[model samples]
Target: MNRRISVAIDGPAGAGKSSISKVVAKQLGYLYIDTGAMYRGITWALLDQEIEISDTAAVKAALDHIELQLVPVEDGLRVLVNNRDVSKEIRTQYVTSHVSQVAAQKAVRTKLVEMQRSMASVGGVILDGRDIGSVVLPDAELKVYLTASVETRGHRRWLELKDKEDITLEEVCRTVADRDTMDMERKESPLICVDDAVVVETDHLSIEETVQKLTELIRNAEKGERHG
Candidate 1:
């Protein structure tokens, strides 16, 4: 059997990291680990308990009591917090707005990064998040920095959640911009492209095209690894 390779996809918010990583993982038969969901899971739990996200101590305290699990399902992975499925809940606008604050906590990042490392240790995993390439999986065999224009990213997100929420495209665009600033400026594991990571610009690419491009990147990486 061929050795399983770890893939890291890192990018700013609404850059299609989640969607693209999922397809790439499916194509390569690798486990898809959405690190952002883990943070969102915690954020949802914090919101459920009414804990202020900016209060690092409170967030860390909450983390001590909750368990986050990502279980693979037919459609995709289901995120569970304290054994309760919060897969849908975490994507809410409230959680989306507060997730960056919660994720920036040092203790939160440390714990989640540990969990992420444990999962990727087995290889054959595609982990996507702001810091997957820089912090969680620094030595991953394949590191891809996927990005798109803020307008494009916001438009994509608006399309995904517009029917479910009472938000406008402009609002989503502002949120995306805010998230990019937070993720980049955060003291802990800020979003950045590693030196060796291949950058994929997806501003104009279709979903299938993006997936196909990443799939080929993985295949080429594998071939290079074998030859090396």
Candidate 2:
């Protein structure tokens, strides 16, 4: 059997990590794991059960019985919690606003990170999240830290949700900024680029361009590994 390679993509919210990672994974015939969705899945459960985000104990206790599963569909992956599909529900503004708090909890991070590691154990996986490169998959074969201007990111996010929600550009920008602060200031596994991670700035690049650039980077890295 051919050895599998693990790719870690990390960045702040709205940096296009998820969308780009999915295309790159598809091109390489690798599994794409959206770690952010896993956290959002937990947030969905907490909201569904009315568990207060401020109550760390309640959140930790709730996680004990919560099960998160990622099922691949024709378009992308669907997140399931306890056999029920909550994929679309988890992406709401309410959930997005509260997910940072849930993700900051040490217990929640520990559980989800373990599951993520297990899923990528055999490699051939592209894991994307705020802390994938720094925390979840530090030893991954290739680590790419993707980033873009906050304004650009906000615009991308707004475009994705303008029809579904009554949000303006200013609101989206503020939300994106707030998320970056929370993600960077969090105590556990805060978002940071590891030393060896190659940084990819996508401020001026199209999605296809970003994916093609990353695919080339991965291919070169694989070649170097084989030649070395």
Candidate 1's displacement at residue 92, Å, is: 1.0
TM-score, cand. 2: 0.96
Against the true structure, what is each candidate's TM-score? 0.96, 0.96
How far off is residue 158 in model 1, in Å? 0.6
Ten contiguous residues with the weakest lDDT in model 2: 219-228
Off by over 4 Å in 1: 225-228
RMSD of each: 1.7, 1.9
Residues 94-131 of candidate 1 have per-residue lDDT tens digits of 89999998888999999999999998898789999989
Clashing pairs in 1: none
Q: Write the per-residue lDDT of candidate 2 for residues 40-87, one digit (tens) a residue.
A: 999999999999999999999999889899999877899999999999
